[model samples]
Target: MKFAKYGSITLITFVLVAGIAIPLSPSPQNWLQFPVIPGLEEKARNILYHVPVAWTTVVAFLVSTYYGFRYLKTRDIDYDIKSVSAAGLGFLFCFLATVTGALWAKFNWGSFWNWDPRETSIFVLLLIYGAYFALRSALETEEKRATLSAVYSMIAGITVPFFIFVMPRIMTGLHPGAKEVADPAAISKAQAIADSAIAVGSKTFADSALATVAQMNVGSAVPVVQLKMSPNMLVIFLLGLLGFTLLFIWLLNVRVRLARMEYERSTHHE
Candidate 1:
C-alpha cells in the first residue's frame, strides 16, 4: 500500500511533466521531442491521462469481481466491504473515462458523442454498473444484498471483457484493433513510422492501455478511430498506465478501510 502510494505519485508526476513539456514536432530531431503522428498531433498527449484512467476502470471492476467471488465462498462480510468498495471505485473511474473520451471526441470529431463502437460499449457498461448500485440500495437485508450483488458482480464482470475487448475488435466501426481501420491511406505514413519504430526493437508498450484517439478518415465527413504513436509517446504512456494502476490500488485500500469503519460503528450501535 505504501509503495502504491509513493510510486503512483512519482510516476504520474513524471508522466505529466514529460507528456506536456515535450514538444511535438513534424520531424523530431532527437529523443527529447516526439514526432507528430499524422492527424493526432498535439491532441495525442491526452493519451497520457485518459487511457490510463480507463485502464484503471477495468482493473477496479475486475478486482471487485474477485472479492465478490471471495465473499460467496467464505460468507465473510469483510469481503463484501472490499467488493463494494472496488465497485464504487470502478464506477468513479468509468465515469472519468467517459468524460475524458467525450472531451477528446469533441475536439477531434466535432461532437462530444459519436457513439463510436468503443464509446457505445463504455456507455452500456456505465448503465450496467449503475443498475448494480441501485439493486444494492433497494435491499435492506445485508446478507441478501451482499449475496445477490456478488452474483450480479460476477455476471457483470464476465461481460466486461466482451464489451471492452472482443466486441470492439469484431465490429467494423471505429477504434483500432477493429476489423477495419476505415481510412488506411490517410495514416499510411504514420503507420509506417510506428512499424519502423517497432522493428527497431520498440514494442507496442501497452496493447490496451484503455483505447483512445482514433485516426480520422480523410475522405469522410465523419470520422473513424485508430492510433499511430511514436516511441517517445509510448514511454510516457507506459508510465501513465503504471501510475494509474497503482493509484487505483491505493484508492481501493483506503475505500475498504473506510467502509469497514462505518460497518463497525453501525454494528456497535445495533
Candidate 2:
C-alpha cells in the first residue's frame, strides 16, 4: 500500500516535471532534448496525462465488473460495495480523461468537442454508467439494488473495451490512431503496410470500420498507445501508465473502505 502510494506520487511528479519543463528541440545533443513532431508539437504533452487516465478508467471499470461478478456468486454485500466504489472511481477517471483530451483537441483541432468517434463512444460510456448509479438510487431494498446494479455493471463492462479500444480505432476520427498522422515518422511500420491498401485509392476510413487509411492500424491491439516516439518520450509515457495504474489501485482501496463504512453505518440505523 505504501509502495503504491509513494511510487505513484514520485513517478507522476517526475513525469509532470519532465513533460512540462523539458524543452523541445530539433537537434538532439543529449537525452534531455525532445525532438518536436509537426502535428503534435506541444500538444503531445497531454499524452502523459490523457492516455494514462483513459487506461485507468478501463482498469477501474473492469475491476468494478469483477467485483460485480463476485457479488453475484457469493451474494455478499461487501462485494456490492466494492463494485459500486470502483464504478465511481472509473467515472471520475473517465471524466478526467475527457477533460484532458478536450484540452488536447482544443489546441490541435481548434475545438474542445469535435464529436470524434472516440469522444462520442466515451460520452456514451459516461451515460451508461451514469444510468447505473441512477438505477441504484431508485431502488431502496439493499438486496434488490445490489442485484440489479451488479447485472448492469456486468453489461456495462462489456462495452468498456469495445468503446475504448475497438470502436475508436475501427472508426475514423480526429483522435490519434483514428485520424492520419501528418508526420509519417510518428506512425508504426504497420501503418506503412496499410499504405498499400491506400494505394488502391480506398482512403475513406470513415466509410466503414474495415476501410483502410494510412494511419488507421485496425490490427493493433493497443492502437491508441502505439505511438512511435523518441526513447525519452516513450519512457515518460510508459511511466505515466504505470503511475496512474498504481494510483487507481490505491484510490480504489480507499474508496471501497469508505463505502463499506457507510454501508455498515446505514444498516446499523435499521
TM-score of 2: 0.80
- Global lDDT of each model? 0.77, 0.75
Model 2 Cα shift for residue 42 (angstroms): 1.3
lDDT of 2 by residue, 1-270 (tens): 888899999999999999998889977677898877645667678888899998898788888889989999999999998899889998999999889888776555444775777889778868877998999999999999999999998887676677667765555465656643322332332354335435655543222212222324433443333457889988999999999999988888888888888878898999
Instruction: State the TM-score for model 1.
Output: 0.82
TM-score of each: 0.82, 0.80
Q: Model 1 over residues 184-270: C-alpha lDDT tens digits?
A: 543443344444444554343111111222333343433344466778788889989999999999999999999999999999999
Which candidate's lDDT is highest? 1
Minimal lDDT window, size 10, model 1:
205-214
Q: Which RMSD values do the candidates have, in order?
A: 9.4, 8.3
